[model samples]
Target: MWFLPDGAGITNWPKGPTELDALVFGHVFTILTTPLPNNQFAGIVRGYDNLIELCKRVEKDYFEKVLEH
Candidate 1:
């Protein structure tokens, strides 16, 4: 499993070989893809929208509970 930065612009690119890990830091987008028969690639999905919402909820809850003390 691997993670790409910003979903690599959400484009359908050709499949190739890579020897290095090309993931960037400070990004939380998980990419999923599939290879085609013609050496082309498909799928550049980025997820974790719900995680942002969850973080907001946790922050609100923490402030309401812990910060009040």
Candidate 2:
């Protein structure tokens, strides 16, 4: 899932495809901005909070396509 805190990049999404398995995006100091959904999804942690909870497997894929866009 793409964590776009800046709300700038990550556009031109697929034409028809939905529900992506893998994420490609960016965030800046994500912990502060991303709110813990205070409604139905509130139970789920957010931002660095959530990242801390989930077992991370970061390979840091800096592909040209995502970067150039």
Candidate 3:
């Protein structure tokens, strides 16, 4: 797995050959893909939108419960 800093160039996914299984960059979660033309070797599993919703729901629930206490 590759844990890259946010804004790192991932379009040319993988960058090079290795035993990479997954990649986490910014709010994007990508998995290794069979190398293809255009340097496309990473497939996005989840993007910011999905993560935002999850975070929102969790925060809302936690805050609501806390306020009830």
Which has the higher TM-score value, candidate number 1 or candidate number 3? 3
Candidates' C-alpha lDDT: 0.35, 0.36, 0.40
Q: Sorted on lDDT, highest at the top, how do the candidates line up?
A: 3, 2, 1
Q: What residue runs in model 2 are displaced by over 4 Å at the alpha carbon?
A: 1-8, 18-42, 45-69
Alpha-carbon error at 14 in model 2, in Å?
Answer: 0.9
Question: Per-residue CA lDDT of candidate 1, range 1-69, in tens?
Answer: 023334657475435312222232112222222344542221222344443433344446444687777
- Cα distance off (Å), candidate 3, residue 21: 20
Cα lDDT of model 2 overall?
A: 0.36
Query: Best TM-score goes to which candidate?
Result: 3
Residue ranges of candidate 1 with Cα displaced over 4 Å: 1-47
For candidate 1, give the lDDT: 0.35
In the range 2-66, model 2's lDDT, one tens digit per residue, is 33222546666454322341332123224324665543333333434434322132223334346
**CA shift at 62, candidate 3, in angstroms?**
2.2
TM-score of each: 0.26, 0.18, 0.28
Candidate 3 lDDT tens digits, 25-47: 22232222334564342433434
